[model samples]
Target: MTDNGPAGGMIGKVAVVTGGGGALGGATATLLAARGASVVVADWNLESAETRAKAIVAAGGTAVAVGGDVADDDAVERIFSTATEAFGGVDIFHNNAAAVHLARSDGPVADLTDEVWDGTMDIGLRGAFLCCRTVIPLMIARGGGAIVNTSSIQALIGDTWVPAYSAAKAGLLSLTRSIATQYGRQGIRCNAVCPGLIPGVRTEPDMLERILRRQPVGRSGRPEDIAEAVAFLASDAAGFITGQALVVDGGLTGHMPTYGDPVTSPLDAPAAR
Candidate 1:
């Protein structure tokens, strides 16, 4: 059943957002904290994470920042340990951390180098695994909790350059399903969000161009949009939803590749444009 209360949207909860200094992660943390959840902004960039936490605290929301390398098992453990020790057990984990090299950025399969592929997979997929491994027991022990892993549309489609990133995100989708299948009876829920054309710091221009060319909405997604979705999945409102991959791409994926009529294509139709 769906819960409809003020606290239905993550109020009085505790949340950890990995890579919280970045646009998407920061947005999730801020939104959760704003709704009365104690947010931990964990990132490899310590200063940025602490700064974000400070901003949240200054705005009268509860927050703390911790630093760790997502690719390192020990670092992941310490991050969770800090969360439990500082604010009690974790009620929500936004497993949003990822690493992709701009030089070898999203591309065709043949161009991927061993170093780039391995590094990207290590952080994007393995790091997500490590976080879930560490947090699932705590969540089960505390009764139940929600996890939302950040994936990308690239996982399903290969229009981009980074093969490793796409593969890693695809793995995350399967991982979400596994968690849901294994622990749904215990009240643990896991899901993934496949965001499209989000405005990353260095990729904003490219992202904007893509949205303009193909996105039906004529704009790229904001981090706030994904954050709102995460908040819902973390809250009791989405108690019945699990192992779902919600694509927040403004109907981009729902439409046909070229539609029935290329000349009158919804994306390229002159008057519509």
Candidate 2:
């Protein structure tokens, strides 16, 4: 809806955004379409993906919806094939599909269950791996491409309660680096966008506030913030940058922690107060 129409950037690229039903994914897909890319919005939730694609079409952008589980090899192949058949070939891939429950308290290693860990890994890490594995060869055949993986602040900092989740994200970061290094010569560029606490469709005010307090900018992230970054990375402006983790946390990780005593913390230093 926002006349983000490619204008000059990505005027003829084909982009695929996994988990296109969710807030971040939806926004990313819409933004890509706006930027002049023919987008294939893939999600496990068919209705959601369809709705998003419809909205894009209504807004005068080009997009289509595809439903599939990124964890399944067959699904991945079929989805890629379908998108390629429709759009000729893929030029950008946003491997952003993730399955995480923020409400649950799985806690540390001792208390974590195999089921929970496996599910998280299967969706977050293995799923991304499978997507890249299937897409990279096709990308090579096309002569080049750009890939942006969605990582989290959790990957860089420790989250004791979600050990498996964090570990999976960390693995994603490493995987991204490995892909960039291994295929940069082949004209494939791989990078990651590390987000802080982003307020998704399910985020409540209390949760948002708590997350904001942790950031130097004092605000939880919005989907548009991420969309803009993705546009940059997917564009020729960032053609020289690859194998990097661009943290979009509004200075969340860069800020010093504040103690109970306002005098001690940088945010609450006497002069600031």
Candidate 3:
């Protein structure tokens, strides 16, 4: 990193990361803490959040864990309260929490039930609504703040299983824009990162090899890949950018599928490390 590094202006800032218990969220929370931000790791799973918080603290970074459902307005308030009591006002917020049951009910919209649809929206859409509603004022009060929301590649595509997941993420993109436009004058900026297939590549490379070979980048995306994007969007570097949905899918969405897999593709010769 240069004198003005990747996390410029993040030092001493307070950040709240919803879903910090998960792979991408935990990685983002850790990265922010390492860059001199005090982070509150909020998650529905109390123990998961606590574990991540402990690891951050152990690594000489500042972090605390708050456990509750992000979809609950009361729980959302508690999250903000914890952030305030721990590190003053919120300066950076990463809305990354979500829920879905893909193995059981996620399918074509016609095949999906109320439970699957409602559950997905409750966390993905409603949860984002509550967090943004609560964080916007805090951000304004603090003079300025950055909000990085986790949208998905699913939102922009047609082929997919989780219909509710796609709809909720599409809603997230719209919500991101609304916040950015409405609060740009109030010193608040909001943006979303639409990450492609993620989370399993690290632990299930063998099983994911086929899908990994399809990415134009010649590899599967890592959680840190998304985390780094979140860090950039939440940093001073992106001060002038907002209301944008950045596609961080290693060019996976950049093709028309005619980049046909030749014999030289990663599938034929194991994906390059």
Candidate 4:
């Protein structure tokens, strides 16, 4: 809720942000509102959504809250309905909801269960599909709009843990490309933001440290980092950009597997005479 200065780019535009109660989503919604967009903060937890919406309003921004399970078709419909009724129409959509808490149940193919896979895909992939399907036409009617899906670095790399989450995120990238290709002429732009280790949610300290050692930036990502990427992709500034996956993980995926390996590290080489 820090003062980020005057609002401008998003003036007169309306935005719908799923998972708005969470770290990354809340940050994105707040930024959009601060930039002058009326935002609908949707989340599975009604109270959390309302809290974010209320904060936006208190900060002199426009926002409203809607609570529902994004996995449900009816809930998705209701989310957009609230957007249309509250602000006339949506010009931006941030499809960010996902079952991150289910990571405990998600595992490699051998240990993964159908329930875990289904639950992960239900919210991460299917939910985004539903939102895009429902919003594309409305955006077409409004002349054009932007959509930024919250993907993950896991989508672009191999990971032993959270197989379902990785798969779902990968699916979002494909979905992003598909939407962009199909709707470009119609003025709708779709992109995905892939975040690295944003630790606030449920990341373990030891695991985070391990990842950080390999990260080129040598640090963990912040929710605001992803939020900034989302806002840009959803703004007029990114008009020329579409069907892209913007990685906001501080160069986590920009290095080789041996980056942190002492045996191959340049820093460990003997100094020349």
Candidate 5:
């Protein structure tokens, strides 16, 4: 067991992170553990989850690995049950699991299959719903807690491919607001972290290059970038923040859509007298 220190904002909190084995999720899980929160690293891949949990333990933090799919109701129960049994109850929940495989199968709405669409929504959106439903009562019982859903920049923009993924992420933002408004009176806060292209994690090389050019930062986002945002929102440091979608895309969505077009490039225009 890890001791709750005075300096950590998450001291004594218990957090459940779905997809905690992935790059972004693992980073968030590690950071949360470092901040004095006992973490439950739940993931569909048991070995991956164990690897993350062991790393935290080696670092003198408290954590456990649970193998399960967030979309399954039974698995969702097992996830929180592990948190409750191991650390008493949940004080934070990070809904970060996603159906990344959808990228291979996703296409324009006209060519999209039911299987692909269902797969995306089931894991991306429904999974979040299941987690929120399961953890809210536990959080309320503990007097309050934080929820940070992992949305995507696609949620706020139009894309030719991956229509289902985009829709699910957009749906998540709506759910975030609903949860915050309905449960804020009970001290339960919910929000989302919309990430831009993080190289090697989600975006393809060609797509990454195109998006990176449009991003004002001129670089792909790091897993730590999103992780830090999640940690802050999940901690008391962001106690006043709720029902909001914090976009961590390095200003990818803050500018005009035609920013990278050569014809519209201000840098290429003739200098004014």
Candidate 6:
């Protein structure tokens, strides 16, 4: 059909990317379209989505912008409905939206308020669930599809001051496995891309430096790094990869940190110096 041999595996596919206005999300949406997938760049901010969609069009890719809150059931439904109407059927869904700044509402377990927890879960956890529920049927109707959840390294380790954020991301891993196992026979693939130390646009220089020092790779992650991993999971290139949490953090979580201590001779190193 529309497949352009090996690389353009997504030639005739339709992709849905939530939070498509964000840095990482926008990169992912663009790359998918570049690889021959028609993308729906859905975001809560209409202007931002339009900007990303326009960029794709300028690059000779097919894309449309849709504005809607991922946490709102009605909005999510409208997002999918628009995609189906314009693109025919859904083949890939990237659930990337989250109320990340809502972390201000979080604190220690004792200080965690119901309001904060509710808002965090609603945006980070429930949003992905809502998108998946709406799109899975579309995938089924189209025979099969792929879903990529944007998880975090925080889910696998202890982080201070953001219990709610940690909990929400952990939920995504469970959701990934559940959907993959349950729908594997039906050709629905679910996977996660966990990023670490990806500094935001507003990240302070000092904070970014600290993140770079902590990361084993000696550098902070870029939006394109996450985009490439997402493309792999969504395309037939990763057909056998499912229900796995692929960490694309430049070796951030590869091993336990020893703070530069010599592995062989912690005591002898001081004496030799």
Q: Pick the candidate with the highest TM-score.
A: 4
Q: Which stretch of 10 consecutive residues in model 3 shows the poorest summed lDDT?
A: 1-10
**Model 5, backbone clash pairs (residues 3+ apart or across chains), number:** 0
Any residue pairs clashing in model 6, and if so which? none
Model 2 weakest 10-residue run by lDDT? 1-10
Candidate 2: stretches off by over 4 Å: 1-8, 101-105, 259-263, 266-273
lDDT of 3 by residue, 1-273 (tens): 112256574777999999999988998998888888899999999999999999999988889999999889999999999999988899999999988434246788787889888888999999999999999999999998999999999999977567788999999999999999999999999999999877452345554665565677877788899988999999998999999999999888887564537765554577668
The global C-alpha lDDT for each of the candidates, from Candidate 1 onward, is 0.85, 0.85, 0.88, 0.91, 0.91, 0.88
Per-residue CA lDDT of candidate 6, range 1-273, in tens? 132434346888999999999998999998888888999999999999999999999988999999999899999999999899999989999999987767667889998889989998998999989999999999998899999999998889897768898899999999999999999889999999998877886577987776675577877799989988898899888899899998988886776565434564354355653
Please say which candidate is ahead in TM-score: 2 or 3: 2
In order of appearance, the predictions have TM-scores of: 0.90, 0.92, 0.91, 0.95, 0.95, 0.92
Error of 4 at 206 (Å): 0.5
Better of 1 and 6 by TM-score: 6
Q: Which ten residues in a row have the lowest lDDT in candidate 5?
A: 1-10
For model 4, what is the error of residue 241's alpha carbon versus the real structure, in angstroms, after optimal superposition? 0.5
What's the C-alpha lDDT at position 67 in model 3? Answer: 98
lDDT for 256 (candidate 4): 78
